[model samples]
Target: MSRAQIEPGGCLILAGTPIGDFRDASPALRETLAEADIIAAEDTRVLRTLLQRLGVTTSARSVSYFEGNEASRTTGLMEEMLAGARVVVVTDAGMPSVSDPGYRLVAAAIEGGIRVTSVPGPSAVLTALTISGLPVNRFCFEGFLPRKAGERRRRLGALTAETRTMVFFEAPHRLADFLTDAAEIFGVDRRCAVCREITKPNEEVVRGGLGDLVSWATDHARGEITVVVQGAPARVVDIDGALARVRELVADGVRFSAAVAQVATATGMRRKDLYEQALAKREEHEDG
Candidate 1:
């Protein structure tokens, strides 16, 4: 497609760079980097380092599109893609636009009818989460928390009841403070993990209660820090509440047996157990 008059606009490729080990990068990511018409990097210097590590040379014009200049640069990059140029975005590490620059450019590319795709590779959030020995079935990646202590606490406080595994990126210097505050709010006994320098030489994962991690982070926290916190424990289903619900359903003109079955299914209790309990409670009430 000619740059001057293309039928369809060029594509925006979000290239995922290895968070630590360069070898984790896919062949597609390297080729896309080498062949792109333009590459927008969160840190041009870091991109150059990665190019060296991957032993790949690229002539694509590299431009800085980080938080500070992202707003100004998105338009130019979008214009380039509009002209049938294959533009790729890479962050210092991991995928672009996750706690990094690239979202604005991607949004603009989509708005201008440019095709958007990705060369998926490594992700620190997933790396830390999996290695942290935390639950993987359900998780929520909470990118860097608020820098201010107050805001950070408020944000964490709001997630006190979260039941899914929680992951967060924190600066090495702030890891200790974050752990300490989390221990206080999430409770000292809350199980957690601190994954430091993930997938890199000297990588370390420390798992323990929040109380224990606070002390560990003070001395051992270094490199890129991703904390995988155990989510607030599942709230115990109140047996009495289930029984009361069954009564309410029966009082609403539903038959007692059906009410017991519905409440049992909803509350994860056996129908026989709930039915027996409800009958016993009714008998006790009548006798009283």
Candidate 2:
């Protein structure tokens, strides 16, 4: 165990584990592994493996806390927190609640008056953004796209005009379908990078438009997928162009709100700004 210690209380600590390559793991995380009064890990086996690799011994108890068991586990963890235990939550990678399983627990802890804190570390979202070849200055992390084909298409369609660099996590099996759908919805030539197995031996980032990516993926690809879609081109300040894009998504059965968001994102304009402008345009169109 490390010398530094965690105070026992109903405090929730969210630790970010390395996405890949254990050597990238931070020393502070190693200390947390030793000091936490209880570790609520996404996978007990994975957490144990990380601890073994770091050569850290723990006096704290370990418990499995993942999507399937989160609801049930929340109660138990909350109880420990209420008992003044320093409960630390971690997923396999990145932050606890982003796309991982710890969100519910964190929400519960907050509602129960438990103090929550985070140990910032490597995040696939940040890593992908850094290497995405897209503007990182203004961006949004969308986490994961919807899994179903219809839902996913509708979702991507709404983002076609989003101007900020958009980051997403996807499964390897659905890579081809997702890319193909993205190409159709966002345009085949829309720039994107499918970052795979980052920071690992087989890590690769395939940069191209959605069309080219679909072609590359057709040959078969593997590893975790993080797709970064380039924001809409800057020429969209032309209200005509923005309206055209919005109408396209709306025609595709996307909701008006989503359509507005995508258009604003693609045009690098504020949502409220676009909405007011869009409403005026809609009224003009109706009058004409």
> Of the candidates shown, which would achieve the greatest TM-score relative to the real structure?
2
TM-score of 1: 0.79
**Each model's TM-score, in the order given?**
0.79, 0.83
RMSD of 1: 8.8
Residue 2's lDDT in candidate 1: 24
Query: Model 1, residue 284: displacement in angstroms?
Result: 31
Q: How would you encode candidate 1's per-residue C-alpha lDDT over 145-206 as one tens digit per residue?
A: 99999999878866876878999999999999999999998899888988888889998888
Q: Report the number of the highest-lDDT candidate.
A: 1
lDDT of 2 by residue, 1-288 (tens): 332244445688889888888888788888877888899998999998989987889998999999899998899989988998888888887789889988898889889988888787888998998998988999988878888899998778777667789998988888899989988877899889999999989899989889998878867578888989888765537777888878788889978888888878667678998888777877888899
Clashes of each: 0, 5
The CA lDDT of each predicted structure is 0.85, 0.84
